[model samples]
Every structure is written in C-alpha cells, then in structure tokens.
Target: MNHGETAYGLWSLVALNSTVFILFAFSFFKPATARDWRSFGAFSAFIVALFVEMYGFPLTIYLMSGWLATRFPGLDLLTHDSGHLWSTLLGETGDPHFGVLHIASYVFLGYGFYLLSSAWHVLYHAQRQHSLATTGPYARVRHPQYLAFVLILLGFLLQWPTLLTLLMFPVLLVMYRRLAITEEKNMHKQFGETYDAYAQSIPRFIPRLGKARLTADAEPKK
Candidate 1:
C-alpha cells in the first residue's frame, strides 16, 4: 500500500504499463489507415506519458512538491497514493484506488475499450461488404471509436493527473474532432444521401436521449 520509496524511478513498470495499455488499445482499434494510425499514435503517446509520470519520474509531483507539501503537510509526495491528485485534492484519505474518481476511471476505461472493440467489429464487417456501418455502437453515435479514445484518455486523466497528459488531452480531442470531420466527408462521398440522413438523426459524440435510434440498416460508420 505504501510505495513511497519504491513508487517512482521504476522504468520497467513504466514500460510495462505503457506497452500493456497501448497494445490492448491497438488490438481493439486495429489501426489500418494513415488517419487511424494518427489517432492510435496520439493515444499511445498519452499512455506513455501517463505511465512515465506514474511509475518512472513523477515529474508533476516533483514540480508541485512545495505547494503540495505546504497545502497538505502530512502528504508524502513520493507515495503512489499521492499521485492520485484527484483524491488528494478532494481530501480523500483512504486508498486512492478505492476513491470515487478512481472507481469512475475504471468505468470509463472498461466501457471505452468495450466501445472501441464493438465499433471496430461493426466497421470491419461493413468494410468487408463495401457497405456503411450503421448498427451497434454506431447507431448511438457517429464516431464511437473517437469517443472511445476520449473516454480512455479521460479515464487515465482521472486516475493520474499529470501536467503533460492534461495538456495533451485537449490537443488530442481537437485532432480527433478534425479526423472525425474528414471521415464524415469520406462517408458522405461513399454513402451520399444515406449518410446525410443518418448524420442528421444521430448525434456526433453525445448520445441523444429519447431520440429515435438508428436501425441496423441506418448510417455509415466513422
């Protein structure tokens, strides 16, 4: 529980965690196109940055040490638990992993990967038939894969608040949004009126409640 001395400076742990997560996401995302690689690369970079600060350097804690020490005098900056900045900031004294933010992070991560996998399955089948992907997760949102990446990033941000990753988050969001727009254009070219109609009915990122759900034969996937 107390990783004060053994928390940071573990390069192996940083690499292990980063590789595991990046590979897990890769397996689900299966980046095939150049655009897909860009999105995957950005997400991989975020995972690496997060793990680097989490188990390798703890740069955020080092930079904010003085402030954190003054703010919470009894806080141990080097402890793994202290790295859960959300818990610390919220005055939660128990194990950071069991905290509310941490629990929510798990939910985000679990569902994010699940959504990513589900979206890929739908897209893959549709692509094989040279058709649009309008079923499953796509029916809920136009860009489920992009939304999955956002949720995953948000999950990591919730678990570990690092300055570098926090800055990268918004940049990734903008990048994904632009990519989504480009993809939508491509879909429009391919599916024409069908895609346009689906776009009108389905929301982009957020799911519209009480709205009519798109049928299996509805819109094209991003």
Candidate 2:
C-alpha cells in the first residue's frame, strides 16, 4: 500500500470506526446544548479527518507528498506506515501504530472520556436538584467534562498531528474558555455566594494539590 496513493476504505470500516469513536465520546459527553453540540461537532470533524487519513483517504500524505518526499527520500510513501507522521518526523522506526506514544495516546483518550462521563454524571445530578456538583471528579476541578474533551483532543494530536486540526484546536480552546466563563456566570447567579466560595476554593480545569488541596465541598465531605 503506497502511503500517498489511493486506498479503498470499505463503507463498513467507515461506519464502524466512526460509530466506535463517536459513541465512546458521546457516552462520556452526553451533550445537552447547542454549544455543546457545536463543540462535539468540531471534535467529530477532527476525528473523521483523522480516520479518513488512517483508513479511507490519506489526504495529508497526498498533500504533503512533495515536501515529505524531499525530506525523507528513503520513505516508500506507499506503505501505510508512512502515514504515521509522528514516527516519520521523529525518525522512530518499527511499528509506529503500536509505539509507546501511540499506546499512551489511547490511554489519555480513554481516561479523558471516562473523566468526562463521570464528571457529567455528578454534574447532571447536581443541576437537577439545583445543588453544586462537589463529588467524585467534580470535587477536584470545576469543569472536568470540558477538561476531559481537551485531553481527548490532546491525545489525538499527540498520536496524529494534522494541519487542519492543529488550527482548529486553539480556536476551540478559546471557545471552550468562553463557554466555561458563561457557565460559571450562570452558576454564580444561581448559587450565589456558595458558588463564589467554591470557585475560590477549587480550580476551574486544573486541580491544585500540596497547598491547593481543598477540604471538599460543604455538602459532600471528601
């Protein structure tokens, strides 16, 4: 299989690949708003583009054919292994797909999704009864779900860096930041001083330890 050449990706492969990843992410995210959908949609696009290159069409390989060929004349560009950008760029040999970084990427992605789902579970329950989500993953960070999504994307970038996705990522980060601010505003208004105090105690995305270890929430002692 030529790296930059055409490859046949069966419809079943596409469906299975898309479904597996999307469903995995959906189970964690459980998106509830238009903004959420938009964010998920963008992430989905990145995933699609990634898999499209992985199985369907090697657009990135094709697009960068000249530069890559010039850079690494030894590469076949026909073998699928050439598509492993990280390996080729870093000069790592052997099976790039099964490399340490690749394996670690999956771990980060799986953990991120798990965090998103667990955090969402706590948050959903809290929002239902109009209480602060101060248990489980929420006990440490405010927006674990959002942070999870970011981690998931970071994992993908580590595994496969694409120009389009690279451009979209920072923009999405900014957008997520704005969304987090808006969500916090609503929480502040709804919960009043309780949320303010909680916000002060806990970090938004990064949990603090050492001097930053918080004494859990007023409702949930952890």
Instruction: State each model's CA lDDT, in order.
Output: 0.89, 0.79
What tens digits encode model 1's per-residue C-alpha lDDT throughout 1-222?
243565888999998999999999898889888999998999999999999999999989999999998999878888889899999999997888998899999999999999999999998898899987778888889999999999999999999989999999999999999999999999999988888888877888999877557644464445
lDDT top scorer: 1
Across 115-163, the per-residue lDDT of candidate 2 in tens digits comes to 9889988988887877888778877888888899889888988787777
- Cα lDDT of candidate 2 equals 0.79
Q: How close is candidate 2 to the true structure, as a TM-score?
A: 0.87
* Location of the lowest summed lDDT over 10 successive residues in candidate 1: 212-221
Q: How badly does each model clash, as a count of residue pairs?
A: 0, 4
Off by over 4 Å in 2: 1-11, 211-222
In candidate 1, list every pair of residues with a backbone clash. Answer: none
The residue pairs found clashing in candidate 2 are 1-78, 2-78, 3-77, 3-78
For model 1, state the Cα shift of residue 23 in Å.
Answer: 0.9
